[model samples]
Target chain A: MTRTTYARAIGTALATAMRDDERVFVLGEDVSAGGPFTITRGLVDEFGKDRVRDTPISEAAICGIAIGAAQSGLRPVLEIMYIDFLTLALDQLANMAAKAHFMSGGQLSVPLVLRTQGGAGQRAGAQHSQSLESWLCHVPGLKVVMPSRAVDAAGLLASAIADPNPVVMVENKTLYFRSEEVPDTVEPVPLGQAAVLRTGRDVTVVALSGLVPEALHAADALAADGIEVTVIDPRTLVPLDLDTIVASVRRTGRLVIAHEAVRDGGIGAEIAAATGRAAFDHLDAPIERVAAPFEPIAVSPVAEDAYLPRAPQIRDAVLRTLGRELNREGCRLPRPTA
Target chain B: MTLDTGHQITMYRQMVRIREFEERVKRTFTDHPGVIRGHTHLADGAEASIVGSIAAMRPGDQAIATYRCHGYPIALGSDTSALMAEIYGRVGGICGGYGGSMHLADIARGFLGTSAIVAQNIPQGAGAAYAAQLRGRGDVVLTFFGDGATKQGAFHESLNVAALWRLPVVFIMENNSFSVTVRTEEEDANAAAGEPLATKAKAYSMPGTTIDGGDPLVVQQTVADAVARARAGDGPTLIESLVYRLSAHGNSIAPPGVPLHYPEHEAVAIYGAVEEYEAAKRGDPVPRFRARLIESGVLTGDQAGAIVDEAQAEMQAAVDFALNSPLPEPAAALNHVYA
Candidate 1:
């Protein structure tokens, strides 16, 4: 095993895919120059400018070109600099890329991967930090995967590049620099599989993307209090690993879904509704959700910290599912009836 | 760029086939009411431009078009019966009823399908050219769209990239006078300023030319020159072929209860310009080319009559086959959602 950051792991995955297959190439704005976060650093030198292409700031054309290239027999990995900017290319992504295979009646397959980052930690303001995975998950032919760990970043990316359909890999900008020990040769982690980071009997806490680390940390803190919280990370949002989540909910009989996106129509709502139906008889308490309020992510660090859902909010959510509350000074108290 | 007698006869035959096929599609609304659902756009007056542009392509070359897509696939040698079935949304469709008139694709014939959205296929055509460039093959791609598509950002961005990378693609914009009901001059800056739409290519540093779309020989020569330049790795060229659309934008869009039919030409219906529509009818490319071929001794009068007879029989067979084909199974919709 070797220690690496999330950014390096993704870069390694791109290099490995390129080395394994001559058809694979990378294109985006400043991708050859390593992009804004340097996630694609050192690729141009290895693959040359022909393979590691830098394009104009035209998201719609970039996506359409990628789709066309994929249809013509190249596996293009397009990087949209920010998930928020993806809105500019939604017509191509949602209409063209997502519908090509189906619209062609199986005569064509778009083996393309669109990589972009989202999450609110750096004060990048509203435009750069929005998590729009829910928008992609709503599409029929798209597969949306978010890798929270360095190891999964390499593994899921390999699988996504190998898959025959269009896959949107939404990385977290906040996790780019976080370091972890990943295996020297990371295996392909198949999509639609959830990882149970922590197993406990008290409650099942399902966290996504950047919130996985926060949930694990919350699990550790709750373990100290003998709560024994169970934390699960759903690596992919589209073909959700509902079986594992439902099994955990059945055993624990309490659930909390957390993410960095707004709760109005976040992925957490889908999971909650699906799990609520699948494990309705097994539930012992109401399901809780820990997510951002319905508003734009703030630019101020202080307000942003309050805006983001973190370990404290997750811990409170877990506590709320157990009919309890955590007051100031970190003390557990009896339930407060409304 | 010069076409021999046999090649000219073949071009005439292809143009006749497209014209006959479109006439049948237009007739289907009244004869076999509701056999075709949704919107169906026709390439009636643009037949010569479509046939001429496709005639420039070689074996490995590919083409992508807008929703007015039937003419290219027909010229590319896709089965006419399957094309008709696709328009009829039958199980025997080229796309197995998955794609209707706007989405016919025959990849084996190098017809890479089309986009229903305006100007969206421009960048995709550049992308296919990018792939052809990477393969080190001299193959080129032809992108077909209407004059209205120039107003979209996709058009400008794709042109800039295709020129910048020297991608092997040719942009063929059939200037059919109107976007839908709105005339081109009302929306386009160049048209409003009394300039050809091909002038837009000047901003991208690529060669742009304008030609009469009604003459098959002119379109074939112009597109052939552009194709040769793209194959030599010189970059993309934009050619604006001016023609007049003889049919409405599409079959009248009505609810299920209201029967769909082809309305009058937009000029006569919207602007009351009966003279303009009549003038375009007088210069209809199919018969114009047929008369030219016969007069030039490239095709005898009897040979031209035989070609028209064959095209009518072929399209009649297509219509019959589509009428006999069954509707696709509802469960089949679940297929092709993933791979």
Candidate 2:
């Protein structure tokens, strides 16, 4: 096993893709100097300026170039600097990238990956830190990938580069420094596939991005209460690993979906709606959605913590679905007096 | 470079076809309201502006234009029947009826696509150029927009990126002096009415030129020079074609059923009567070019007249084909949503 951080894994994956395919290139602001988060460091040195091009401060052009390059026999991985600035490029991303292939009667293919960072733990203010994955996930043509682990970052990006359609990789800003034991030779993890982090029969906890590890922690805590919650990390949200999630929910009869995006119109809502219809007959109780409240990520640490969802929220949600004791936040009570 | 007489005639015929097609589509809407859906923007007086610039490009070069895009595809050699079917919302359309007049795209001809939003194509065009540069290909991209697009952030962003990277891109701005009903005066208080829109290209370290859009031959030469500079890896160029839109901004920009109030020359003239206004329609690109072709001996009067008649017949056949084409199956919508 090789230990690596999410940022390094991303850099390695980019290097690997560039080395393997001459058609694959990287572009963004300060990307040659690595990136704002240092995920693209060392790429320019190895690939030279031609492959690892640094673009001007134009999100629309960055994304538009990716789309054009993808359509014209190139795989371009572009960075937007921050997820909030994605607003400026939504016309190109949503209207142009999303609709080009379909509207062209399948004559064109946009094999592009839009890489951007989003999360709210570092006090980077509202504009810098925002979990806006739900907006892209809502679009029809776009594939939204949220990697929670270092290994998945490398694996998913490799697959995204090779994917025949447009994919948006939303990297959690806080998880950039997080390290884990990844394979020495990282293998590509196919998109629309979910990984079962923990095996439990009592309940199913489906989470994404940074919340996956939190859900696993919650599952460990619930084990003390004789409640085993199945934790499933759906790496990609678009062609969602619904089969794995629904199968797990059918086995457990209760479900809890967690995400960092706001509760309203969040991706968790879509999972809840899908699972409700698919596993309706087997569901023992209503689906519980554990996500941040409908508010922007605040600068204050305390307010941000309260506004975000984590392990405690997942544990409480699982217990409540199981008809266990109630506690503060009106959720289920904690493990008895351990 | 001087275009051969055959090439000039071809360009002229294509321009006539574009005008005839738009006029035919407008008649379809008037003669049959249900033929087209929603509002439509027609490129009537801007034929030379669109056709001349496209003539400067190689067949493989990518071209993107604005919402007034009907003329560009025809100028780029897109199938007229498919374009007509597309506007009529039929399965046989270029985009299979999914993209109407506002979103006509023919990738086969290197026409990337058109965006309804003003100046949205600027950044996208820059991207196409960037990709070509990355691949070490000499291909270039021509992005056509309006002076109104100059106010859009995408326009400036595209220029900055194209200049910084020295990408092969030609930014063409058709300064028609109006953004819908709002005149250029109200739209841009910064620039004078007759100011050259091309000078804005200097901020990005690229050559900018303003030319008379009424003459196709001049437009062809100027854009050919810009496209040459781009293909030579020297960088991007901004070409502002001073033109006009003889038709309503959209089908309903003017009064409910009015064709056009008057041409800009007659509208501003003190003694500009309706007859003079009608006479100024002679300045429209089709007739003006027809006269030029005759005077230049590139084609005789009989030959030019024959070409116009041929284009009108072709347009009528396209309308017939569009009306006859079937509606796409409902399930087709779910097919390409992913790939």
Candidate 3:
């Protein structure tokens, strides 16, 4: 296995898609300069200027034009420099690209990929730090994809590009530099397929994006105490693999869904509702969702730290789902030795 | 002026057909009462603007239109039964009945689609042209939106990029004298067409024109010139076809059997002063163009009457087709959401 950073994997996915298909092109403000995240760096040198268009700072054109290009026999991978700017391009992405195929009665397909990085660990402040996957998920014609690991990022993005519909790939900002083992030849991770990272019969923990690793770490920590936890990563949100999730929940009979988006109206809430309906008879305990509170992510490091979910928070939620109560002193463990 | 007699007759027939079709759709509701069972925007006054310009385009060239769009696909020669079925929300509609009057599309005929959002079709048209340029295909794209859409940022950005990349596209602004109810008056006839909006195209380094939308042949000749320029790789052009919304912004979606509020000849406060309506009525292209055709002796009144008769029969057939079409199965919705 070749070791690659999450950002590198994204670049490789783009290069592969471009090499595989001549119809694929990349456009956005400063994309030729590799964008603010540097994921698209050096792709221009290989594909040439025509395919890697450096658009004006007009998000409307960046998105709307991409949709137009898609329908007119091109697959455009458009980058919205920041998820905050998605508001500006929502008309084209939500109303135009997402609705074209269905609204057109299958006459046109918008094979477009709108890529943006979101989440708040780097203190980029409120605007740049929102996990707006829920907004895209709300739009019926769109496919929402978030990959937690470097390997999955490359695979999922490849599949998203090959699909005939519009896909929103919201990457986690904090995962850019994270390195992991990647295969020499990558296989596309199909949309709506969940990956079971750990096997445990006691409880099921569904994690998304940046929180997947935290959930894994928390599960390992819980394993030390003989309370095993099942961790599932729902790679894609729209064509969600509910069968895998509900089946897991039915076995565990308890669930804890997690994400970096706000606690209310986040994707986790939808997952909770779905599992609640499908696995209602099988559930032994009430479902728990570990996520950021309903406040906007703060710029201050201290406040941001408190806002994001930690391994212990996920572990504690899992522990609670397992019906573990606090000691008389209200602490989970005895006082630490000096 | 250089148009052949055959082309002029074709243009006249197209104009009369669209006018007759919209008139029939406007005044004839079945099953209960009112004109149409659903609300639809008519192309009564803007037939010249739509037909004149589109006549210059070759078949299969990419095109887009705003909400008042029946004229666009009709001018492009899309199947009448399909367009009417779509507006009727039947399974046989162009969009399989999913898209109503405001969202008709026939991508196979190269009329890419239509949208309800003001000025939204501009950038999308530009993108199609961008694709053409990338593939080295010198196909020109024509996009139509109302004057109210000029205020949208997409209009400016689309023109800017189309000009910057030398993308083959024609940005047609149908300046129909009103922003729904707000009067956007310009002094000179030409100026009123698109003076402010067309002249602003200079900022993007593209040629812009404010032409006589009242004359279909003029619009056709002018747009044909721009289409040539685009195909020759001269980049995009902005042509503002000044016309009037001779009808209501759109017929109200009144339920069958209720007295329809927005009629063809009723002038009310919602449409501005009666004087404006009266003035616009005098400029209606349908009767004026028919008179001109008769005066030129290129055609007789008998010929114009026959064209209307044929258009009426065809429209009646389309209405029958829509009424008889089936509904989309309920399970069809769950499919095509992906892929």
Candidate 4:
């Protein structure tokens, strides 16, 4: 195993996929120059300009071209600079790429991977920092996956490129520079599988994308007071590993979902509703959701920090589910071991 | 560039076949109400342009178009019976009735499917061209859309990239004089300024030409030159084929339980221009091509009559087959959601 940043892992995955398959190529605005976050750095030097292409600021056309190329027997991986810009290409993504296979009655399949990042910690303003994975997960023919660590960043992307259907890989901008030790030869993490980071019995915390680390921190903090928590990271959202989540909830009897997106209509609501139906009788208390407020991500660092959901918020939600609360001084009173 | 007498007759036959197929689709609204659901667009007046452009394509060449899609696949030799059944939403349809009138695709014939949205298919065609370039084959792709699509950003973006990359693609713009109910001149700056829509191609540094879409031979020659240039890896070309649509934009759209039928041509219904519509009818390309062929001694009147009779009979059989095809199982909707 070797230590690497989340950004390098993604770049390694791209180079690996391109080397393994001649049909796999990359295209987007400034992708040849490594793009804004530098996740695609050095791809052009290795793959050449034809395979690692730079395109104009045409999101819709870029997406449509990827779809067409995929249909014509080429595997194209396109990058939309930021998740906020995905709105400009929604028509092609939601209409053409997602529906091509179903509309053509299985005659066509778009093996295209659109890699983009979304998070609100960089003070990049509302236009650049919105998390919009919910919009993509709602589509029928689309497979949405989000990776929270360097290891998953490499593994999930490899699986996405090998996938036969169109997959959207939503990465986290906040986690890009974080260092983590990953396997020397990263293995493809199958989509729609949740990883159980920590095992406990008191509460089940379902975290997504950027919130996985925060949930782990909260679990550690709560563990100090004799409260045990289980953390699960659902790597893929569309074909969700609901069976694992339901099983976890059934054991813990308490669930708290967390994400960086707004609470209303977010993926948390869907998971909450689904879990409520599946394990209604197993719950010891009502479910709690820790998410951002229903407003645009602010430009100021202070307001953005307060607006984002973090470990403290997750910890508080876990406390609430346990019929307890954290004081205003950010102190948790020790309780009897559960 | 001259086509042989036999090839010319074959082009004439394909044009008649498209006209007959569109005429039958139009007649179904009255002859058998409720058979075709949702929206259905006809390619009555653009038959010459469709046939001529498709004639320029060789085997292994691909074509993508907008919702006015029936003509290209027919000219490319897809089964009319399955095409009609797809429009009828039957189980035996080309797409298993998953795609209706607006989304017809015949991959085996190199007819990549269509996008119903205006200008959406342009970029897709460029992408297919990109793939063809990588395959190291001389195959080219033809992208078909209407004059209205030129105003969309997809058109400008695709043209710019296709030109910059020197992809093997031909952009065929059939200027059918209207975008739904509005006249083209009212919505297009080039048309308002008395310029052919093809002039927009110059911005991308590509060859652009305007031709009389009512003449198949002229369309055949113009598209052939563009296709050859694309195959030679020079760049892309944009051809504006001006033809007047002979029907309304589509069948009248209404909610369920309200009968649907074809409304009058927008020229008469919206613009109150009966004389304009009548003039277009007098110059309809189907009969106009027939007269030119006969006068030039390329085909006798008896031979043209036999061709039309054969197309009419063929389309009649297609209609009967569609009417008899079974409806798809409702549970089948769950299939094909993934590969």
Which candidate tops DockQ? Answer: 1
Model 2 chain B weakest lDDT span, ten residues long: B260-269
Instruction: Give residue A142's error in model 4 in angstroms.
Output: 0.8
The digit string of per-residue lDDT tens for model 3 on A180-285 reads 8999988999998999999999999999999999889888877777877899999899889999999999999999998988889888889999999999999998
Q: Per-model i-RMS in Å?
A: 0.6, 1.4, 0.9, 0.6
For model 4, residues B1-339, the per-residue Cα lDDT tens digits are 799999999999999999999999999988998898798999999999999999999999999999998899999999999999999999889999999899999999999999899999999999999999989789999999999999999999999999999999999999998989878889999999999999999999999999999999999999999999999999899999999989999999888877799999999998899999999999999999999999999999999999999999999999999999999999988888998
Q: Mind giving the per-residue lDDT tens digits that candidate 1 earns over B225-333?
A: 9999999999999999999888999999888878899999899999999999999999999889988987888888999999999999999999999999999899988
Off by over 4 Å in 1: A328-338
Flag clash pairs in model 2: none
- Report the C-alpha lDDT of model 2 over A254-328, residue by residue, as the tens digit: 999998888899988889999999999999999999887777778998787677787888887887898876443
- Better model by TM-score: candidate 2 vs candidate 3: 3
Q: Considering TM-score, which of the candidate structures 1 and 2 is the better prediction for this target?
A: 1
DockQ of each model vs. true complex: 0.82, 0.63, 0.79, 0.81
In model 1, the Cα lDDT at residue B95 comes to 90
| Shift of residue B139 alpha carbon in model 2, Å | 1.8
Task: Please give, as one word, the docking class of candidate 1.
Answer: high
Candidate 3 chain A has its poorest 10 consecutive residues by lDDT at: A329-338
Q: Tell me, per candidate, how large a share of the native contacts it keeps.
A: 0.72, 0.65, 0.78, 0.74
Colliding pairs, model 3: B29-B35, B52-B220
Q: Estimate each model's TM-score.
A: 0.98, 0.94, 0.95, 0.98
Candidates sorted by TM-score, descending order?
1, 4, 3, 2
Give the lDDT of residue A57 in candidate 1: 93
Q: Residue B176 in model 3: shift from native, Å?
A: 0.8
